[model samples]
Target: MASLPQALPEQRAVGPVTRPAPPPIARVRRRRRPSGEPPPLPRQLRASGKWWLGLSAAVLLACVAVVATDTIRYVDVADTRVLQAIAGIRSPGLTAVADAAGMLAAAAVLHVIWLTDLVLLAVFRRWRHLLVWLGVGLLVINVGAAMATTLQRPRPFEVQVLGDWSGFAMPSLPVTVLAALLVSTLYSLVPPGRMRTIGKWLVCGLLVVTAASRLYLAQDHPTGVLAGIVLGVATPLAAFRLLTPNAAHPVRYTRSRPAHLDVSGERGAAIVRALQDQLGLVATDVAPFGLAGSGGSTPLKITVKAAGPQDDGGSCVFGKLYAATHVRSDRWYKLGRTLLYGRLEDEKPFSTVRRLVQYEDYVLRVFCDGGLPVPQPLGIVEITPEREYLLVTEFIAGAQEAGEAEIDDAVIDQGLAVVRRMWEIGMAHRDIKPANLLVRNGTLYLIDSAFAEVRPSPWRQAVDLANMMLVLALRTDAERVYRRARRHFSDEEIAEAFAATRGLTIPSQLRRMLRQQGRGLQDEFLALLPFRLPPVRIQRWTWRRGGLTVVTLAAATLAGYVSVGLLRSPL
Candidate 1:
């Protein structure tokens, strides 16, 4: 009762401050997303090595200025103290060894190393690696020597010189040359792994020891050594960035038989030169495959002397060349597909030639790793920025169509088994036609893997089964193909397969062959094999749907505002 005077303020019903509660509407705000196109790459990403180069270059210039002006003369004392400290630990044996190691990384030895590396690279035909090696050498040795000579800074005075040397002190020619040579050589030659990591640490240790040796021998100042190290690391990396963009090969093909190619044309000649210059390939001859499709990529067959590492100096391989016109077409088609229609063809979203080639190369390797039969992917080559790209692969010759080969039960069984294997591997060959299936030396090889996809859904896998069965139908009876397929497919799966082919794109060549063999292939497949239609997904909300929703909400909001204005109007 005493607490009545101290009762809850909220429960005081007759309080003057009483207020009504807000209406509990179940609406949530929809935040407007930014425009679909991605923002530009960051400055660091766009410039890459150039940013590091600029920073290192600025530091180098500042060090040179400091040494020239003697603005911080006491800082130079640290340089002298570093030398004295290193010399204090120096023994005759360690000095001799360091001196010898220094001599090994000398200009003469470096030049010899460069020449020898180039010759061996020429032997293995590691042209890109050779280019990087040469570029590093020139950037480190020649340009560094010139910079040192121009700076013309003097060596430390009143310091005990353990070894003899003559040079400016701004950038230690020894440090710059040795660091760049070691880093660049390792970068180009060593594959990324534990070995590469070990190589980096070893190089780093050597560089530090070498820098310490220069200090101990009273060869250069600390600032000079620091400048040399920065220059050495940055210059070679910048050169490497410029030299290699697309790897050793950059082409991919969609079809085995192309209707048009000009290997002797201007673009073809440029392609040959690019391969020769970048990859060190001696092209004995180049021939066009006359690939079909107006802008689709095709492979050019090339006979080369030392085209690959395992070459006996001469071998034949397939090369796909993509010039400026074709690259743009690919870009436009992919952009349109993604932004407008939002569909991918054969699971490969359209991209540049270099990237697409890389994807296929990776896919081919995966298939090979899993023991699937496919052409061995050789390498990729980029001639111009986005204009010219080329991809090389092992050329399998003397292969004919399934239609040309004997259409026995074994052939049918093998073909169906392959489709099953593809499905087992979660792969789908979107372009499974008789022409793409080759019979070579009594073995079936699946070719034109450009449209191949992995990890397909059951619906997509069913579509592939239908396509494979259709291709086999070209050589023999549709019923015969159905019997072989039924072993792998259930009734529901088979029904879904038939239903999936409603609007599948068929090549004109395969379409003609199917019509010639019999009537409508779809009808024949349905009549020959018993099947039922499977449920399909209706497309959910798209950009259009969301856009319409937003528009309706905005329109209602506007109408309410107008009504409020009319209510407020003077009459």
Candidate 2:
């Protein structure tokens, strides 16, 4: 029930006279309220908690009252016929399946799954989901066991037990434990799409089968099973609605699925299909490579490579889609960077995805021709009128991050070589983070050149070297990295580098990481290079351009009007 993302209105202007479109009114988010009041509790929890609390209390009271008054018989009316129907439908095959399901629903299985889930959630830092799981498990076990003993309800069968049955069976503990764990685990961890849907249906089928087995095996009455299911489902559902992560976040790991024969699973299926047609090859699978999102703009991934005719895509290619909205944001972000860094983010007219795509393609061509290790840009594909453009490039499979590899002199040489090669061609990669540099089969490869340019600005070049220094220092000792870098660069060059990157901005998390690792990469670089670079002109539309022209016109017009008024006064 989100209230945002209202659709654009369809109305149009009637008059011939037209006006320039208005700039978007900025929505100023107040970080703190003027009243300095704590945020109000959500109605979801307040109202639902009251209702659930009352219902749970009433149910408990009713259970106790029924036990005390010996009115449990009234609720057991359907137990006899339900048991009869279940027992009559039994067969060897059905019995075998029931036995397997009974084992699956056993308390031991639930315990193991719960432990595994906790380990996973802990790794993901999904603390809220873990809390929900722990709370629900505790309630179901203690409360269900207490009800069973207090009610003193008998097993449906009088014969010697075919399997281990615990205590009285007023509320089936097995059903309660299994269903609660399955539902909560699935709901909390599953992402949106077909995978989630299939998981839900599969869990539901298992629940139905397990519930029937309880009745057929004469382990509990239908009422007991029904009670277990109600408590199990209701508790987890209510808890998780209030507990799951409230925001999208980046995970520490990436998961790759085995490409299926069809591309239906992919969100960019239409774009994939078009690529398939263009290549004249059947695309058996698609792997989405969206930059794990929310905190930053994400790039889309389209690859039918896995399930292609070969082990890899028949063609050695991968695809990226830049959505229109992201393009608009890039324009503003590039402008901000230009102001702060005094470097051109992109050519004039603003940073559109189309413009970036073209720039990237041209840059990649330059690298390919110059014998640099970079991905070959294939072509560009347009997917929509809103500027959803796709860039195709050669795939470099199983590339390792620089941080993951050994940070010895050899690795340092590879990094230096890449930067020095770019410098030879008067090029600079403004962003030289650990993620952007990759190593494959002992060779370093550079990817994500969307922010690169052929500008040979001294400061910009120095930023690349300084950023690399910071990145490598995190992996190894500062002195070792510095000594290795000295072999490739002189003291003066190193000094200029640190000087050039005086105002570099890095991601907050990365900054904290460098701090925790016993050294400041940038500080160390600055300490080595005491001198700064001289002023150099960079292409940008400053106030000196548009603003200066407008100001001059206004001044001239004012002077002319004043002169005319003086002449009239004299007359």
Give lDDT tens digits, candidate 1, residues 245-332: 2222111123432213345545556666666654555567788762542235656778776423565645667777664445545554
Worst ten-residue run, lDDT, model 1? 14-23
List the RMSD of every prediction in angstroms.
27.6, 23.5
Off by over 4 Å in 1: 1-261, 276-281, 293-295, 305-315, 331-348, 516-518, 535-541, 544-571
TM-score for each model:
0.46, 0.46
lDDT of candidate 2 over 95-145, digit per residue (tens): 777677677667567667766777788777555566567667666777887
Query: Taking the candidates one at a time, how many backbone clashes does each contain?
Result: 18, 1
Which candidate leads in lDDT? 1
Instruction: Return the number of clashes found in candidate 1.
Output: 18
